[model samples]
Target: MNQLGHLKQFRSSVPRKRSMGRRKIEMKTIDKEPARLVTFAKRRVGLFNKANELSTLCGAEVVILLFSESGKVYSFGHPNVNSILDKFLVQNFLPEENVPKIMEESVQGTKNSQVVKHEIMTELLSKVGVEKKRGKALDQQREEETLLGGEWWQGPIEDLDLPKLNHLMLSIHGFIELAMAKANMLTLGTKNGCK
Candidate 1:
């Protein structure tokens, strides 16, 4: 095994009390560059090994961040710690004032859509009213002609048949009645509980 591997293997083999002096020396001040570097390397390896053991035993993710004496940074993570931390921060770390702004934007979009739908419905209702008025006027004109020409509705209005005109009037009346019923349903739904 390498020096770090040996250190990790021997670390637990030595009792805690027995290794405390050297562990402190390893972590704290050291006289020589070689000695401190060696300690840092070995301890870092041992720490990573211990982290792996903890992760395996407890079914947990592990991450480690270390800064060397020479000012370089080292990092280790089991499953993209930075991404998970970023997601956590995004969900849980927003300022209170920012929340109201997001809510206001959502409300504005909903209101705009509702207003557009209302305008469309209003236009359709107006068209229905216009059509209904036109149908009533045409029915009235046909009824007047039937009264004036007593036998004019017999075959067809174009051929001046009074009975045919009467039947045509009845069909037109039935169609108008169905149209008005449908328009009333639409209007009622608009006035009552509907979206």
Candidate 2:
């Protein structure tokens, strides 16, 4: 059996060896984000490729989620990625207290998105002096379009089927309105509580 093939298979796994032995390699802690980011990028690509190959060769499913030292996430998998992760999460039941607070804030902020959207639209409409009837109609059009799913600005407006086109427009308008409204309420609540 050729052991060389295995070595070649995981070339990145070979740690850099010290040219001189006996004395431990004096290493300094990494303090720079750019340097850490570059190292992370190189290693992440290598890890992802290895995972892909392992899955292909062994006829086994594989999924890997990596958190870089600086706190960025990278993941790779064969078959369904989220399922594997969900299972692990359920099994572990571990709290990620070490994860940066900003990531948590971003995730939490995205919750209750529709209300946030509506508030923003309401504010914009008010500023622009748009009539409530027109706003409601626009919101309705955007709502329907969102249910269908697609970017509205890309295609020819006239070419779309009347029903589908109308749906898309309504969805966009509705999404904005919902998000804006939710945001306004959230902001107001936060302010009131703070006071």
Candidate 3:
């Protein structure tokens, strides 16, 4: 055979090695502290970049507060974290009349508002804890489904019967309504001193 034919035969005989690159990681808690730390660092940067892009692209304000396993705080904001937080608090908690005065007061003496800030921070942290619990529960449910070799919501939509579809729709609608009611109540409570 000619050299070209021999080269083709040799290439066919040699098994091509798979690409040596990062493998997909399963969604789970990383057991190793060092590996977890590294992953957190990398993913945190990625998350911040995505947040920044979203803010820029959508002309939306964004604020991210992250706490590492070691309790180190990392934050990112579009304009300024304090400004965004102030806007959120003003819009959600403080009355329209109190906004300017409160801002002025906070600016005049940081110590004067420390207690109020602390209380607000505590409330926000509690909310975060509640959200974390909810997320953990969802994660646990997904894990259980995976272990059982089935995901409830992953199959073809056309496969669902009408009753099943209607039940799912009703369940989702109820959930949305309940969540909205809870949110409205929380907002009212915050407006009324959260007592």
Evaluated with lDDT, which candidate comes out highest? 3
Ranking by TM-score: 3, 1, 2
Q: Each candidate's lDDT (Cα)?
A: 0.64, 0.62, 0.78
Error of 2 at 78 (Å): 1.1
Residue lDDT tens for model 1, 152-174: 54554578457666767776787
- Top-down lDDT ranking: 3, 1, 2
| Model 3 ranges off by over 4 Å | 1-19, 96-98, 105-115, 124-195
RMSD to the true structure for each prediction, in A, is: 29.5, 22.0, 15.9
Each candidate structure's TM-score, on Cα atoms with residue i matched to residue i, is: 0.34, 0.30, 0.51
**Model 2, CA-based lDDT:** 0.62
Can you give the lDDT of residue 103 in candidate 2? 36
Off by over 4 Å in 1: 1-27, 91-195
Best by TM-score: 3
The TM-score measured for candidate 1 stands at 0.34
At residue 67, what lDDT does model 2 achieve?
78
Q: Candidate 3 lDDT, tens digit per residue, 1-195? A: 999999999999999998869988999999999999999999999999998987776666789999987889899998867677776787666658868866875676676565666677798789879967866866786688689987656688788889647746865886896797689768755553422
Per-candidate clashes come to 11, 31, 0
